[model samples]
Target: MDLSQEEPADWWEVEALYDLCFAPGRTALSSYRLRDDVPPVAQLCLCLWDESDALAGVIRYWPIRVGGQSALLLGPVAVHPTRQGEGLAGLLIRESLKRARAAGWARVMLVGDYPYYRRFGFEKLEGVQMPPPTNPDRVLGLSLTPGAWTGVSGMVTRATPQAAGHKDATDP
Candidate 1:
């Protein structure tokens, strides 16, 4: 398999892969609420392809603020059914986290199973919260910078429009 930074041109193919892996109702999840009008960190989005060039998996990260501290919200990583158990998802996770740290992001958070993400250094975020219907236990975070997650706790809100330099759907 080959790995590459996801480009805008890969949107539909990536979305299709997500749909196939997560099913059509994925958008209704609480994580999607955080991303509703937010733009993902383009450099952190990644795609993997097989030798035949078919998309094998995809991952994305969006910007959010935890108590006014800038952070990346990692999510929606999906591997093609055929690629399951081959570690494509893990590859995407590791690569994206490495890039995020290099890019100066202080922290990253995700709503996922503890056992799976623990290996990546994600720990339970005791005081951070996502919107309703999300199991709080699934909220996990990793500090890219030493002690970055320390004292970082609050309602996870969408990053300010000025920070992202673009208007969100809620903007008038």
Candidate 2:
């Protein structure tokens, strides 16, 4: 599989992949609340293509703040039905996390199953919260730098540069 950073032109294709993989109501999930009007971390947004050049998988990370500290919100990773058992999802997760660490991101969070994300070093984040209706147990985080998650707790909120000066709606 060929992996590359996602380009702007790939938006619709990526969305289609997500639609095919997830339920139609996926956008209404609490995780999508944090992504509203926030741009994804460009370098960390990735796409995977098979030898046939068909898009196989996609993953994205959004900028967010937890207790006013910068971090990333990883989510909506999807693999084509044909590539479901090929480990393409894991590839995207590992590659994107590597890039995120090298990009100087201190931490990353995601709302996902522990059984799947735990293998990537994600652990349940105590005192950290997502939007309503989300299971607190599914709120997980991984530190890229030692002690990065230490003392970080609070609601996850958009951390876009444009919102830097203003208190985030989700901030406590």
Candidate 3:
């Protein structure tokens, strides 16, 4: 598969792929609430295409705050139905995470199943809270920098430039 950073021209295609893979009301989920008015991490938004040149999988990351500290919100990783079990999801995750760490992001979090995300080093975020209607059990996090998640807690909210420890890591 060929992987590339998502470009403006790929917006509709990426959205269509997300629509195809997730529930119709996916945007109603709490994660979307954090994404409102926030642009994703452009350098980390990745698209994977098969040898046939068809889009196979995608992953996106948004900047958010955890207790007012900068954090990455990873989500909406979608692998084409027919391409499931091909390890496309894992590939998308591993590649994007490497880029995220290199960009100076210290922490990453997501609302997802522990069984699925745990393999990627994600664990339950004990004191972190997402917006209402979201199950706290699904809030997970991984530290990109050693001890990055230690002592971080409180409400997850929209990110401000000040929240992003590395301004260049976030979209302007």
In model 2, the clashing pairs are: none
Top TM-score prediction, candidate number: 3
Residue 144 miss distance in model 3 (angstroms): 0.4
The number of clashing residue pairs in each candidate reads 0, 0, 0
RMSD of each: 3.5, 3.8, 2.3
> What's each prediction's TM-score?
0.93, 0.92, 0.94
Candidate 1 has which clashing residue pairs, if any?
Answer: none
User: What local distance difference test score does each model get?
Assistant: 0.86, 0.86, 0.89
How many backbone clashes can be found in candidate 2?
A: 0
Deviation from native of the Cα of residue 71 in model 1, angstroms: 0.7
How good is model 1 by TM-score? 0.93
Lowest lDDT block of 10, candidate 2: 163-172
Kindly indicate the candidate among 1 and 2 with the higher lDDT.
Answer: 2
lDDT of 1 by residue, 38-73 (tens): 677788889998999999999998888888777889
Candidate 3 Cα deviation (angstroms), residue 118: 0.6
